[model samples]
Target: MASALIMTGPLWFFTPIQVATTVIAGMNCGASTLQSPLTWPLLQDEAIPAQYSGKQTEWLLHGSEIIFPPFNGVCTVANLVMAAYCYYKRNDGLATSAIASAKLPYTALAFALHVATTVYTLTIMAPYNQKLKVASRKINASVEKGEEKSSATQQEGIREFRDAQAVWKARNYGRGAVMLAAAVANAVALKVSAGL
Candidate 1:
């Protein structure tokens, strides 16, 4: 039993570092994206049509789509596993109660943040994303068929697209803040566990 516990110990030891690094990377990516001129170009040129503006915003956001899933996946899986293992070890007399208690709250906080980010994305951002996708498809199809650029329907689509992108960006910023907090908590967990 002692041998088994020692063998599996590194998972708890190293996973928090991975979680913290991934979260911080995600936060920086989001903050930089949000601050980019192309992200909110209205400050530069208010005259740009809503359609083009929306496309820029959508594409900028798409850049993050590739990175977020893997980051969140690793954080969620690793932290939850670590938390459970810590609890098990403590109960099994492999870890002392003080160390376990010290580590568990931070690990649990990181896990909760990961879950919160996912829930926020699904509940708050999904609808806007769906609207943005639909509007983008229609607008692209019309532009492809060489339709006149300023048709009333096209303008309406652009307006919808822009609105969705704006809301998504704002929600994404909130998600980024959550991720930042998770990173900090994970780092603190690592420090607490290091004494073990």
Candidate 2:
């Protein structure tokens, strides 16, 4: 003789909110980013030499310009939708404390992080991007004219541009870290939704 177990609910129990939350959170954590600025440095350092930096940087930067705005916008919208879903489920236990003295508003945290990234792009990256554009153009123009670095000023300008690019590269690590945190936050949100 064998015993059989009977289940009360359907085989699948995911509601619409839960499904949507899972989808968006899955995207945040598992998907690749739309931005490729980080990879440009590899090309700049290894494949492309300093002499070709102007043209390639200009090309890559323009490509980034075309892609990132809408991509980041979509990210913001996704975060908004996530926050809304989390909000609607607040009464379902999401609003409760996650740990001692700490409330786990995971979706809210994710949304704030994305907003901060946007603000950073606007305030910090924008000016630095402008500097890069100008430097690339100037270098290209000079190279095109076959002007060998004859003066201290020209050399200094090149050094400045190189330094600026280095700083931009370093800064992107911070950006990557922030976005990683956002993804982790969204992952937590997904976990919370499971219990609901």
Candidate 3:
């Protein structure tokens, strides 16, 4: 997991940035492979029937929330700790030390990327998530009667649900882009520092 790699970023002092970047990039790649088409599309399909789609999406979002938050929280903590450690180590003596002098910039870059990813998730994804949760709760979960016309109010809720899902999916691409870039940057930093 990316969190584990980030947590260990400080430990890889000999090649911290390089290792961190490589590991985070690899994590991002793995996540991308799993999420796009594979996971999100399946979740989209699972929401059968116009009536239940919002609830299904809510369920899907909840499922994802359960998985994502804990890991992200851990990653956040790890990044913060590692960033501090990197700062301390850089200030202590690495600034003047020949081979280690380059670490400060790389370390800073990695930390900034990590922070950026967190910010992107919070500012961009979190609001949509909250809306989805609220909509799911407020919307009726029962199947609509086949003979009866869907109430205009019910239709509106369904539309809002679908719209939220669309918006969330669109914004997720941006988050993924940021993460991918972060991973790449981390990896590049590793290569620059470690020549690996």
Candidate 4:
């Protein structure tokens, strides 16, 4: 019993980090997923208080904005820890692992998933975020102070702007899917690559 416990002792340190990594990935997925069911349509498309759509729009982005930056930071650390084991093997120590021989492949997959999501955020989503910011400013300006309705001339622009927001929302769902893939990858890594 003592010898067996000693043999598997390396697992103690790694298990928590792997679990944390998986959980963070899940939160990353949920951040984008939450917006899909309600925020875009009710708050953005047909805002209850149209002038207040600016506030609603900002609210929609707030939770994701909080999570998005730090998520990459955590993912970077997790990848490095996993990659270290992959590159520097401790054969016999963890040779019992199914993923021991697949060291490079598992680590490579984890890295790829993280990078893909980051690229999607920086390239695909950043532009839409900027556009939404600019449009929100324009929207606020269009609604004159104390006015219940916007200028009729600006209605067309607002319509187009809302359509843009809808497009952005749809695109965000794709990012959520990518994040989910990352979560699953990390979970598999957590399970099979523990001894790599």
Strongest candidate by lDDT: 4
TM-score of each: 0.75, 0.68, 0.69, 0.80
Question: Lowest summed-lDDT stretch of 10 residues in model 3?
Answer: 141-150
Error of 4 at 138 (Å): 0.7
Cα-lDDT of candidate 3? 0.58
Q: Which of the two candidates, 3 or 4, achieves a greater lDDT against the reference?
A: 4
| Model 1 C-alpha lDDT per residue in residues 1-196, reported as the tens digit of each score | 5334433664444544554655564665465446433445562244875556657656755765666766777787777977776676555544456666667887788888888877876787667767887787777777777777687667777777767666766776776677777777777777665555
In TM-score terms, candidate 3 sits at 0.69
1-196, model 2: which lDDT tens digit per residue? 0111101112122234334443544454333232336455564573454447756666766776676556555656766765665455445543232220121366568778777767876776667677777777666666667777664445655666677677766666566566677666655654554443
Query: What is the TM-score (0 to 1) of candidate 1?
Result: 0.75
Question: What overall lDDT goes with each candidate model?
Answer: 0.66, 0.56, 0.58, 0.68
Inter-residue clash pairs, candidate 4: none
Better of 2 and 4 by TM-score: 4
For candidate 4, give the lDDT of residue 16: 65
State the lDDT of candidate 4 residue by residue for 76-172, as single tens digits: 5676677676566535556434344454455557667888888898888877777776666666666754433556635654675677678888898
**lDDT for position 71 in model 4:** 84
lDDT score at residue 150, model 3, on the 0-100 scale = 63
Count residue pairs with overlapping backbones in model 3. Answer: 3
Q: Which regions of candidate 2 are displaced past 4 Å?
A: 1-51, 92-104, 151-154
TM-score for model 2?
Answer: 0.68
